[model samples]
Target: MALVIGVVSQKGGVGKSTLARLIACNYAASEWRVKIADMDLAQGTCTSWNRRRLQNEIEPKVAVEQFLNVDDAIKTGEQYDLVVFDGAPHSTRKTLDIADACDLLILPTGVSLDDLEPTIKLAHELKKHGIYPPKISIALTRAGNSDVELAEGMEYVRSSGYHLLDGVIHEKTAIRRASDEGKCATETSFKSINEKVDQLVQAIVNRADELGKK
Candidate 1:
């Protein structure tokens, strides 16, 4: 069976789709057959991004499709090595479905209380619905260049008694530009930015592996 990963959020513009595409493309580049299930049907974010990627003829060729239901995505996912669900913004019944379906559920948020509060609350909701705490992770994204704020954000997640991923994806114009060109954060033109994103990616991979063993 394919390893399923979900990128979900309490609200939009919090790097949810960004993390989904990043994970899909990195696994695909490593020669793994990867599929991104774009659960945000109204937005079709990953679906449109894949179209641009194909047009650009980017390597490894990640497959992306919009699915109205989690069951259908899981059924289709069995054919690939990995399936990444780019879930819709805001909590819905489907959010719990994704939480139940995925081996790893990643919640990406910014440094502010606005983002952090809802992200942790969603995590709590998932737990209330019987989702394992270790199976869920919090990733800091679109962070400003303030070390102190980043550290505080990390502490907030940790203090909430949830696992926090090691690295932060600092807000960068280059990353946005790469996405506009159908590229992931790890595929940016700047080597430094690519490396920084890779740290978070590696942490994600490691967390998934650790969870799989349990």
Candidate 2:
């Protein structure tokens, strides 16, 4: 059976789509049959990115599917080793439905207050609705030099009592270029960022392993 992971956020521009693409590409490169389900039917960000990925001839083996329904997404998950879901900002119901069906849920958010605050609420909501799994995690992205700034946000997240991955993806121009070229984060030659992404992938896989042990 395939491992299903959903990347979601209540607000846009939190890098949920980017995380989905990153996971799909890297997992596929690792020899897993990976597929991405673009649940954002309106934005179609992942869909378009997949097209660009094809144009760039990057990670050709990774498949991308644009899905409008939860049933179809569930079906797609059954066909691959890993399925990464990139959901729309407004599609909470659809996203949660998929979450309920996933083995893990990745809520990618920026370290800034604007992005992190609502995610805290969403986390509670997901738990309340029984859609969040023990494997659910919050990934911090687009981090910058604190000088006390970044640390403040981290403190806030910690104080709020939520699970956050140990790895953080620093802001880099290479990430933008990679997206523009439809390449994965690791393909951008950003070794540091790729290392962080690798840590994230390992963390998730380890979590899944732990879950199966129980």
Candidate 3:
């Protein structure tokens, strides 16, 4: 059985697509058959990205396809070890439907109240709709300064009664630049940022492996 991971958020530019691609590329590199379902049919961000990734002939090749329906997307999971879903930034029924189907849901957001505010609301909505608390987590991406600040952000997320991912994607131009060229954050220029990406990937993949056995 495949582990279906959904990278979702109600706010735009929160690095949801980037997170999805990171997961696919990491698993594919590790030789764990991977495929990405670009559920944001309107934007097709992951679809276009996969096209560039192929054109550039990037190593550890992974595949991606776009689908409008969650059921159709879910069907693709049977073919790979992992299926990463990059969903739209909307509070529509489709978003919740995607959340309902995933084995794990990753909500990427920045550190401040502006980013955390809407995310908090969405967290409540997911819980209200019966999304298992352990299956959902808030990943702090594009975070601000220092380990201290990141620790504070973690505390804030915990205080809000939501689980926080262990890895933080700091604000780094190297990450975005690599994405433009069809490269994963792990392949970016900064070793520090790359390490962060790797750590998060490890945590998420471990969870998938743990759940897949059940």
Candidate 4:
């Protein structure tokens, strides 16, 4: 079975789809048969992004398909080396199902109580549903260049007994602009951002193996 990475968030504009596409883009570039299962059927952000990606002739194409059910999405993953799920921004049975089934569950959020609180609640809810913290990670996304805010966010996530990824996605115009061009922040001219994105990707890939060993 293909390794599944679920990118979930409880609120919109938290970079859920952006994070999913970043990972999927890098994986596809590395020759992994990657597919993004856009779980947000109503929005279809990932699906539409993929169309723009194709139109712009982005390298190492990745497939994006929309699905309403978690099981149906997993079945499609069977044909790929890795499947990245762009989950919806609201609570749903399908969201929990995806969290429980994924090799690694990623909760992307900004560094604030507004983002982390709901995300932590969702994480706790998933824990109650059988997905433990070891299989879940909190990714700091769309963060600004505030050391205090970032430190506080990291500490908050760790104190909640969840893994806080070291490589954070900063709130950069380059990140947003790259995505608009069907590219990832890692593909931009910003070397520091690229390194961070690469680090995050490596950690996630290692996490999949880490969870599998348990």
Candidate 5:
């Protein structure tokens, strides 16, 4: 069976799809057959992005498909090594289903209270629904260059009693441009930005591996 990872958020513009694409691309680059199940039917963000990626003929091709339900995605994903669920921006009954199905669930948020509060709340909700705390992680995304603010955000996530991924996805014009061109954060032209994204990806991989052993 393919290892399933879910990227979900309480609201939009929190980098949920970005993280999904990042994981899918990285795993595909490593020669793993990966598929991104774009569950956000309204936006279809990853679906359109994959179109651009194919048009650009990017290497390490990643498959992306829109699925109305998680079970179908999991069934299709059995042929691949990994399946990444890019869930809807807001929580619904389906959110718990995704949490139940994933080996690792990532919640991406900004540094502000606006983002942090909802992200943490969603984690608590999942826990209430019987999701294991260790399988749920918080990733800081679309963050600015303020070290103090970043530190506070990290502390906030830790204080909430969830695992906080080690690196941040710093907001950069290059990353946005790369996304516009159907590239992920790590595929930007700037090597420094790529390194930062890679750090977070590594942390994600390590966390998933650690949990798989238990």
Candidate 6:
């Protein structure tokens, strides 16, 4: 029973794939047997990222795979401690299918109205499919410490009947640089963003533990 986490959303450029890869790379580096299944065959962004990771020698410790379907992706589920599914944008059917198969669904949205709306709609859609997990959360990415706009976005999410991660990752050049190097934030020398991502991982682990007791 691996703890499967699906990173999903209805919109693109919301950092879904980036979050998935980051989590997978960091968790694996920490000695957790981790696997990442990229379900977005059209873009193959995660898959390509992993490829670059291999070529650049940044993915030495992570096991990443690309799959076109849920069943194929779950084939090695029992072998790993965790499985992360990086989903395609705007694919409700595929997203729901992955939701049904995961222990947790992590919807990553930025601090903006455009990003928030689709996230709320996505939550409702998952509920409608009856595939809602015991733990479904919203994560705030690309945040800024002094930005009043980020605060407004948090207020909006609080009003939407959903839970947001207590730790918000600020928009930093380090994130993009680390990604390009095929390294996770945790593996980079930067501490600010890495610490926040670690907190996000801990929160998910805590929620998954709580769900297991139910």
Off by over 4 Å in 3: 146-148, 210-214
**Per-residue alpha-carbon lDDT of candidate 2 for residues 88-192, written as tens digits (9 for 90 to 100):** 897779878877877778888888788888988888888889764466778887777663766776777777677676666667888888889998666777777
How far off is residue 200 in model 1, in Å? Answer: 0.2
lDDT pick, better of 3 and 4 = 4
- Global Cα RMSD, each model: 1.1, 2.0, 1.6, 1.5, 1.1, 2.1
Clashing pairs in 6: none
Worst 10 residues of 6 by lDDT: 205-214
lDDT for 60 (candidate 4): 79
| Superposed Cα deviation of residue 57, candidate 3 (Å) | 0.4
**Cα lDDT of model 4 by residue, 1-214, tens digit:** 8989999987999999999998899888889999999989889988888888899998979999998788988898889999899998775687788887788899998999999999899899888877877888999998888999999999999999998776888898988887888887688778887987888878777777778831
Candidate no. 1 TM-score: 0.98
TM-score of every model versus the real structure = 0.98, 0.91, 0.93, 0.95, 0.98, 0.91
Question: 1-214 in candidate 3: lDDT tens per residue?
Answer: 6878898898889989999999899988888888888878778888888788889999889889888888887787788888888989874687788889889888999888788888878888988998887778888998877878778778888999876777878878899889888998898977888987898888787766665532
Comparison by TM-score, 1 against 4, better one: 1
Q: What is the lDDT for 123 in model 2?
A: 83
Stretches > 4 Å off in candidate 4 = none
lDDT of 6 at 190: 83
Residue 52 shift from truth in candidate 3, angstroms: 1.2
Tens digits of per-residue lDDT for model 1 on 1-214? 9999999996999999999999999999888999999999889998888888889988879999999899999999989999999999865798999999999999999999999999999999999999988999999999998899988898899999999998889999999999998999999999999999999999999999998731
Candidate 6, 82-138: lDDT as tens digits: 899999987888898899888878899988878889898889878877865346788
Number of clashes found in candidate 4 = 0
Candidate 1 — which pairs collide? none
Shift in Å, residue 1, candidate 5: 0.2
